[model samples]
Target: SCLTDTRMMIKLRAANEPLFTGRRNAAKAAWRAILKELGLQGKISTYQMAKKWDNLKRRYKDLKYPPVGMESVADGASSWPWFQLMNEAMEGRLASSAPLLTPVTQDDDHAPDRTPKHRPRPAPPPPPPSDYGPEPFGGGDAAEPSDGPLGDLERQWDALERDRAALDRDRAALDRDRAAVDRDRAALDRDRAALQAERLWLERERAALERDRALVEQDQVALGRDREVLLKMRSFPVSFSVSIYRPVSEREPFAGCRPGGKPEPARNKAEFFIFLNFILEAEY
Candidate 1:
């Protein structure tokens, strides 16, 4: 996304335009048309388009590839000479058509603005042979002169180049850090997904356990009724197993309790009920 957008902005700025509002509006209209082509007309609005463009412009405006031109950046508090150059270039172009910068009357005027005087350029030196190439190191005019404004400008440019190199290194380090952060975020996301799956499994197991508990409660109810009927019947066999009709010693009817731990003989239905509940706890 960044590559494609930077390329597009490079093309638009090749003319050295500051990309004012009218141009941005035109670009926004073009975007709407593109959305229409993509069958996304309903997802378009002027404010949204303008906002996207504004954000892109603010972010990419600082993206100077080699950081050669425009030495100063105006951070909203003060004016810079580079901004004056841009304004001069713009006004120079607009001088022919637009009448916005008109002369003010004496009554309306506060003070005359001091425009910087531009110096005329010197004539170019004769070109060398095409095959000769650039001047060699420490040879001819390739060396930095020790005086004059030109020398100062050269020193500034070299300093800016060094600054740009440092910025590039910082940006590369930030990219590596961002990649590591993304990897950690992806791993965290995987762990979160795994936790969600495990929680779901636990929920299913709890539901199965609840169904088993319901079945056990139902069995207890049925077993109580069966015991009541047996107690009411004098023909009840003393040798019967509590779980099933397996044979046991004629006296050991309490599902083979501990030796000599035979429950006292029940005298009534209430005692029989107590015995039945005690045996039921053993899953009899």
Candidate 2:
């Protein structure tokens, strides 16, 4: 009885074998088609596929469950929401990590509003015709006359005349001072010229004195030479002597000589003649 039951079970499975084989073959072909379409056949490991599915699920945290069906499994159980969430998360991460890549809003990206908040306007002024001229003395229409204490226009004219006279006086005084300065300058020039002439005269006098001194020295030298010649002539002894007694007195014999006899001393007549010639030349 057990062998018969085992045979019956084998026949039953063999009778539906084609249908089961076809289902398994179709499942294999579908998986190959999905891997080829996603281009992750041999490149993606079972562990890597599971990690990608987990990451997708985490990115779409709003979704409570993974997508159903064999197509979802092939695509790592990812849906449109999952992709959108992942993209948004990547954008947020980029923005936080790099300040330069911050998302820009349309309103902020456009030119800012530059319209002024408030306008400036000039204040209105009083009418021109109503207050045309200066306000009458003290805020009244009829101005009080200026005739109290001080006269009117005539007194003002007199004051102006006095001021003009005083100015004229000052101008005349300044003119006089300028003339005096001119006279002083002229006097100084004259004095300088006189001093220069005096200096020139003194220089001439000094030159004349020098010339006179030179002439006097020449005369002194000539006198010394004449005295020297006279002394040379005087040094020789006289050969003759002159008798100073008159002829009548000569009857008495002269001293140091014999009367009417030969003279005891001989006289040098030639030296005496030369001495007399020198004395005569010197005297002339």
Candidate 3:
């Protein structure tokens, strides 16, 4: 089936969208979506879509601006099916310094009679936008291989993606380290609390020991006083006194004390006086 004017316009408009000029993958995806929307996915591959867009732009540029010697070349572009649609889509996109018409000099007018006028080939379209890189339109003219700005942008995008992946890995590692640090801090706090409790208990035990020591000191002092009193008592002399009653007759004093109250023998008087002197000396 032939593509209608409406379908050609749709293709031109879709190709000119910003999404079709982004990163390679995104641009290809956008082109696939455009093809799917046009119900041409099975018939037209993504590569075909890209090539079609490139060819359209090249044709539009050729028709819009004829080459140096082909001033009247664009005269037939109006009859082309997609020319108007491409012109509309590519409005203000193509930039050129070449004059649309070449000035005729009197010497060149006279020299033109020597040969038939030849139509020069149209030049390639202007470079794409700086932000966008060249799209890889496979099967395009080999002269217009996918290179230049598009290749540089693709490489830069790839580098940026690699850097982003590295940063993500670093961020994940940092999060894990932070979690471990928090756990370690919690453990240290628990240890500190336990040590504080143990210190308090030890202090209480020390206080109790101090009290016991004080009581022991007081008991020692009291014991020391009691010991001093006992020492003094021991150092003092102990004496016992006995009295001997001298009767009218000293020889008969013990005789009256006898159980029968009988008179003592005169020979026992000397021994009795000696016993009395021994008791007196012992008392002194």
Tens-place lDDT digits, model 3, residues 1-284: 34452444244344435453334355445554554455553444444445556566676678788899887878768666667656755553322211122211111111112233797688899666322222332334323323334445544544553465467569779999999999999999999999999999999999999999999999998888777766654554332112223343533445345456544555356556865575454444
Clashes of each: 0, 2, 2
Q: In angstroms, give how far residue 23 of model 1 lies from its true place.
A: 43
Better of 1 and 2 by lDDT: 1
RMSD of each: 22.1, 47.9, 24.3
For model 1, the superposed segments whose C-alpha errors exceed 4 Å read: 1-147, 234-284
Span of 10 residues, lowest total lDDT, candidate 3: 103-112
Q: Please provide, for model 2 over 6-45, each residue's C-alpha lDDT reduced to its tens digit, 9 standing for 90 to 100.
A: 2222232223222222221232232223323333444332
Q: Which candidate comes out best when scored by TM-score?
A: 3
Comparing 2 and 3 on TM-score, the stronger one: 3
Question: Where does the lowest 10-residue lDDT sum fall in candidate 2?
Answer: 102-111
Clash-forming residue pairs, model 3: 133-150, 134-150
* Superposed model 2: Cα runs more than 4 Å off: 1-157, 239-284
- Compared with the true structure, all predictions reach lDDT values of 0.42, 0.41, 0.53
TM-scores of all models?
Answer: 0.33, 0.30, 0.37
- Which prediction has more favorable lDDT, 1 or 3? 3
